[model samples]
Target: MDIAEVLTLADDLIFAKTGKHLDYVQDAILRGTLEDATYTQIAQELYSSPSHVRNVGSDLWKTLSKGLKKNITKNNFRAVLENSKIYNYQSAIVGENVTVGENVTVNHNFNVCPEKARSPKTPQNPEPTAKQPRIDLGDAPEISTFFDRKSELTTLENWILSRTRLITILGLSGIGKTALTLELIPQIQHEFDCIIWRSLRDAPPLASLQTDIIKFLSQQQETNPPNSPLSRGGEEIQPASPRRGEEIQPLSPPLSKGGLGGVIHHLRSQRCLIILDDVQTIFSSQQLAGNYKPGYENYGAFFKQIAESCHNSCIILISWEKPREIAALESHQKNCQTLQLNGLGESAREIFTEKGLSESEKWSELIDLYQGNPLWLNTVAAAIQDLFSGKVSEFLSYDSLVLGDLEYLLNKHFQRLSDSEKQVMSWLANQNKPVEISKKPALLELSPSEFLKAVESLRRRLLIEKVQKGDRTLFAVQRAIAEYLNS
Candidate 1:
């Protein structure tokens, strides 16, 4: 494959497993090695010492091998590449039909390679464009400029293809669950005969959804030109709807109702994909109790019916928390497969590096403080860009991030905890050393029993992790959790 396609594939592979992008060093080393450049030559080209080049090469090999689910070394990495379809990628640069591996071998004149210039890489512009304004809404309020979520996209695609009956993505707010779902749709559109995306915020009544389904199915029939009675063009060619007395129109191609009942009637036979965004807003337990309080509506039965009946169609649920009914579907202790998205990875430095800090140590510290949440990373980056005018050294010397809207976004999630819980968490965060909870109860000003209850609650919620040292179980809030509480 051409070098551009090769880079995209490499990105896809790395992101698919680790949910992180390839850093610049990784990208540069991989490309350099692919072109058969020795460590010394690569060092010269990349402006690094030969030893640094070798270390980067070693790290790249380990990262790629782990991501690709196979062992790979620089010597064998190219062999694997040659065997993969990406190696045969076609490139039409200046009307030259150049197959990546055949026409442009990596050896003798590697520096003159055209693929190096055409690689699909993030630009070196370190700062976010001025057009992207700072926005702060609850959950994912801000648009992250440094998003590198390739693996999550790949995993979503795999879920669409694999034999799994149902796939649910569960995570806390602002974790990029929605962003990841939207990114995967365009890539996997061809896999499904029908792809219907709906936001549950304004979930129509059952009748409206049923009617909408029939209308959608009819449109599909017209496009595919299936031999069904409903397939007829009108004077102005209006979209198809089931014949008034037809009762149930078949859903699949060459549609026939084989007891899938009327709702799915014709649509059940084909491979379909339905994505429900913000499912938590619609699938609440309180809604099913017939209490029409604001957003309460029992969608449990609707979900259960769809899951139990549909065979070829896969239903994707994206929610902040798992709905009870969906969680109960898995028999035994095997819970439904849930992909809990965390934060962006350290590789985001490649993005920051473009704005102009090439040093790894400085970038590592920034990523550590932000924990690599794309939105947060971008926010701090914007502040740094504005404050220092792209001076990486000056930016690192600062004590705190401006945090624009991140503080408010974090407050919403943190406010859900009880007052005592917040207080205990803050205490743990301020402690200079790991405070043994059993003995340090007086320091926290909580009775022994109450302290135990509060600590257990935090652990259950995954806000805190217990560090066991001999007989003492010291408690500390997780970095992200602590940041939210402290903010």
Candidate 2:
């Protein structure tokens, strides 16, 4: 497998089993030339201390070994690599011809031509290799790392099993959207005859993207147009090797239909699932100023087509923020499902306990404080282990437990709010129960209209819950976010 594909698979494996994110050091190690470098060399290259590199390498081996269901070492890392077929190939296109897979071979033999014989040309230089920084992957969570996200997993499974052509998961930043999506890959991968995930993080050129899609799907290179110019910016475009091919056609125009109508034809005929995660960056509205920092233009229409037309295959969109414009397209024919995820449940206790924390005297209070936000729990748990010499139960009683990362975990979400908005939210959080905005507008120093608007925005973001009593509407922050603020 190519380095990119291997790194992607390794990352997915590490993150899926373990709820921990890969540190930058780990990412660098995975992408670096691992064959020749020693731990000390890696440390020097990453500008980190040697001990840190050693630790990262040790941890990475453990994680990979666990994921592969066997022991992993530098000697066996290559063996583990051979056993996996997760991302062996991709998709591509040529003129009107489209293909899927990689490593396509062209059988071409040429005799010396008169034109070639007539001219003497200087030899061209080979492209220079980039000098990549060294890093250690051992510092990241082991592959066996796991979070308690049963509810979110179940929700994703339900949506996948639902007869919906399109399902969208919406939430704010760091809300576990990526984690949740990665977690689901293993569970649902077996259900479909084929499963493909494409990251729209860097929205490439449309033609280039289409080429990649076709290559991954068709498994062969489509014949290019005759005498087509292969050089762009003075660089020659090399032909790609071919793999397996499944014939398909693009869906009919109005193109909101799955952009891969042609591709889905093959998948539907064979039964498959396609996950397009973080597609929000692609579908985000370009009209909004500073909205999506450019390069992503008019992708909403593309997604609308995928949802409306693709039925034989499932297209899942995992995104931080929902495209509000999609609400209009909700119709009988289109099965567009939206799921908003929250924090972990009681199961998180198991996660913490497994991490070596003892039963807490104030179990409920501690859990309530962290609200079982998976990342926060791990961060707090690690901090507790590193700092506290006392038992977990005793540590719970001290303010130090609350003062560490747990406090920031709770406050991070609140800190995202504007000063005026946070003041309003803080007041609501401190309330014994829900209070009508009108009853507390003076407390926040906002006019009635402005207070109402702020409340609505928070509610839409799922930071707060709203209730209606007679003619008045009361707003309260969700118990989780509130606990953070009140903590």
Candidate 3:
């Protein structure tokens, strides 16, 4: 029988037996089984996760098996129904059915029929099957050598496995946001059925991104390849090759409905881990941090839905600054959280040692000067080795911290700040310790609202930090940022 006919008969049998109708996901699983589709294929079609589909299929078979009084599974479900004389039989027992309040029972004499009694029995102990996890890391940088994010990785893993839907990894550029995420994958890959990593380097339009992601989840190729581009910004960067023995299928045509709904459907259906790196690229560069660029405003809604919607998947955003929506959502939502990465502390020494810098009394001083940033320390370590024979004392003998390429990096961050934000940074640079908002009015000559706005802006940009002193909230710039501001 065709799929529709099978569904009709099965639905009737199921409802009669249990007084309940199969849900859409369950019906879809049944249809998929009739078509001989794999669980992954069924999940892709339903925009659900493969593991969820498998569970639904398993429950469906067990229900049918108990109801039909015969072993039924994905492999033999069609055969069992076909061989039961269900099409020609007119009665439940010899053709009679009994009904009770809101429930109907169909009795079939499977014990008398040798063919029905001798059907292949379902395996009680099924062999463990290796699952192939779909990984798509689009344009995420490769980490050649990673270090000292053990604690951070463990925290992130716990968050993901605990069903934290939205997580933001915030840090300065080259502070190992990408490295930490890359290192995090291997640790958490087993928990998820699919892992997707996309970079927002060129700031693609949110709609286009949604379409791309949905297509991937649906396991379909682009229908209008020449007419539609994968990414709206620069040339689309291809994802790396899948691990050996993993099959990487070609992109198929787009889904019928291409937008947030489709994406959410997949998320709800599957256990996926989606990583979006360089998320700051989608924000307006010259405006307040976290404000989306014109066309990308929809991203805020997308993220908000992913955080608020009931879904089993997790999305980790690696950004220089937290998105504005995230800042607001995380305040009220438990599943959404932000992790701000600070300097590597003693871990900075590893970068220096790897670069052949000798240990000295001034090593701690140097590390403190660079705020224990691995990239900053590595850059200065090479300079010290070249200019001072790798002597930490020689590097520390100078009254000022080494600027090197750090100035350029800081410039990129500074250039994105608004005038008010820059003003706050300038004021904080002159202070030795954190200052409270109450004290800013006299020094800045701005209104209370303006002052608070500027401080909030700086906080979002990650150019300043808030510390609690007594009952007051104080703000301070990091040493590296202060040094850059002074220079």
Candidate 4:
């Protein structure tokens, strides 16, 4: 029999014995074993960690061994299933009764012990009528003392509830993009059937991410396909498609037309909230802002499709810099929006209050100097308490801003700037106040187009701000950024 047939039969037999169907990961592991693929290979194809795949494989083998009443392992699973075809036929004939060993008998009636079904049970309560949504916040940083952002949270909720398919949270690092999303989860988790949180820090390939998400959404179905292994006994099984590497390939005509139809299908069928954190990791660091790294260009298409396509799901992309696709798609599409997160403003004073610093007039200037970034304020507040005996005025009397731990933080963001961006930033640093674009000095030796491009790049990178100056637009870097540039 073919591999699909074998997988179908295995699913039925395992369900018959264990009163549970194989999950997508378990099914993939079984198929991989039949195809002579290793855990690493399967994990790569599935966009899952290898250790997670191996754990699922181990549990599947153990369940099958108990169900078949024989030692079933990855090495011998195929042979064992092929040998049991006749027994499977006989078991179907017996109806609710099956012979396990020489004298052992097993019952297949699912209703007799309803509790033994595959569904999980609550500790003190009976089985829930509906499955609880799966929540996976992988490596998301915990926020202990989350200050303000109430209005932002409400805006996010309104967007998600309005069926907005794609939302991008744009901000500088340590500007609370992740914190805002974490805060939003509790308010919106009930709205989605499944809520997943994944970071693009390692920049997994787009295909792998699509496969992983599709698998998770597909597994929410209540029943398996009818053309299962046991039902297709002597039929031909088509070979699995060749694995795609990390490089981008031209999509087949069908896939190109569909634009990830499988993933969209699941999104249409289910309400899922997928939060992709650290999305800036996928962009090329040395290039202009919003440019994708090699082999990652497909991500732009993926995001565009998600934003434009009709689906019940919502995707929240949290990034240090906004992607170019977001700017294009969000402008024309009502269902897509971008939330640019600034610092905490007056609410940030709470950090100083919590740090036991005595409040004074200087507190406002200090907050302004750091742009109200909680991480930066916390570091500065600690410095003030330690070096100035918890006196804010004493610390502010110095001629310059304290660059203590803030230097390390600012250096990280500054190091990623393109040459043009650095030059523009340095020019802005020397300005006494916000300057209009038309009034920029000609000493920089840039044309109007080049100057505007650099300014736009800086805006995307969250390194500069644009403001209205009567009639012309004025741009200036934040105090912290200006300090970094001047230093």
> Number of the top candidate by TM-score?
3
* CA-lDDT, candidates in order: 0.54, 0.53, 0.72, 0.72
Give the per-residue Cα lDDT of candidate 1 at 457. Answer: 52
How many backbone clashes can be found in candidate 4?
3
Can you write out model 1's per-residue Cα lDDT over 25-107, one digit (the tens) per residue?
45557777778888887665444457765765776677677655568897888787665433443322111232234234332
Off by over 4 Å in 3: 1-129, 220-254, 470-472
Clashes of each: 14, 36, 12, 3
Q: What is the TM-score of each candidate against the true structure?
A: 0.52, 0.51, 0.69, 0.66
The C-alpha RMSD in Å for every predicted model, in order, reads 17.9, 21.2, 14.3, 15.5
Model 3 residue 103 distance off true place after TM-score fit, in angstroms: 52
> Better model by lDDT, 2 or 3?
3
Per-residue lDDT of 1-487 in model 2, one digit per residue for the tens? 4764556556545554553434445654564434456666655544455666566667777887766667877666665566543333321111112231233321111011222332234222232222121111221222445566787788778766554667777665445666676677677653343455666666655445544454444431233222212222233334222223522222122222234455544443333456666554553331221134355444565556656653445667676445554555555443677777766667667656766765655445656666566676677677667766324666666643355554555564454455556777788878888886655456678777766656655654466767888988777765646656766
Q: How well does candidate 2 score on lDDT at residue 233?
A: 24
Which digits, one per residue and each the tens of the lDDT, describe model 4 over residues 16-70?
5545454445666886898899999877645556776777687678877875668
Models sorted by lDDT, best on top: 3, 4, 1, 2
In angstroms, give how far residue 240 of model 4 lies from its true place: 30
